[model samples]
Target: MIWKELKKQWRFMDGVVIASLVVLSFVPLVVFSMNHKENSAKEGNIAIISIDGEEVDRFVLNEETKHKEKTYYPGKDKYNIVEMEGTKIRVKEDNSPDQIAVRTSWISKPGQTSICLPHKLVIEIVSGKSSDEKEEDDDMIITY
Candidate 1:
């Protein structure tokens, strides 16, 4: 019935446009799925902890990872507590008022992230690199 109504009000060009838009919508899904698969295939996922845009620590998210919490001091009296265990990580506590990162709970996927703007802290999960890949990237530079 909907198609019949559309047919009466629409022309061939309209149908072509709608079909093109529908196909276009799936293009991004396909692209993102491919990228996700590539990242998820890494041997182990890694959680990167950054404060003020500099990486301070990284933890391998795997079954053997110990259950522990670490406190980071980004600035004077500004701190964030991160906890990790069994392939999952989270911001357990922080000095930020909003507590958004803490409420984000645990993140286990490669692309998940938690940010605390007030503390300038960020925790992100990323795909792990093999030894050869790590060696190749060792030359990457950092600036002051």
Candidate 2:
């Protein structure tokens, strides 16, 4: 009697496993098909530096060759060095224990960013040019 019950339940378990496998296969395809847009500071070739939600400085990456800016936070001894090399930008030196920002790769893209969370500082590349000014249609889009 026990063997019969076990054999009957095995079929239902097998169906559940098969259904799960089918759903898993489709998950990756759906994820890959969707285009994820990043929120960017639209200021063109400029990098915005903000500290504690306030804009502290902005740098034009193209004109600026190579330099470093030290950020000092009041009441805190922590400091972060924002470095720019050619068109690339990164946190070159940080006193934070993890040094995650220092370890991050340099970014050159218009929308790329590097952050030092300990100092509450964010560095983001911007286009400087507003997208709203262009009213003409471009060939980059395709319609059915």
Clashing pairs in 1: none
Stretches of candidate 2 above 4 Å error?
Answer: 1-44, 63-71, 130-144
Give all TM-scores, in the order shown: 0.64, 0.56
lDDT of 1: 0.88
Name the TM-score of candidate 1.
0.64
Candidate 1 lDDT, 49-139, residue by residue in tens: 9989999998888777889899999999888889998889999999888999999999988789999999989999987777798788699
Residue-pair clashes per candidate:
0, 6
Q: Distance (Å) between predicted and true CA of 122, model 1?
A: 0.8
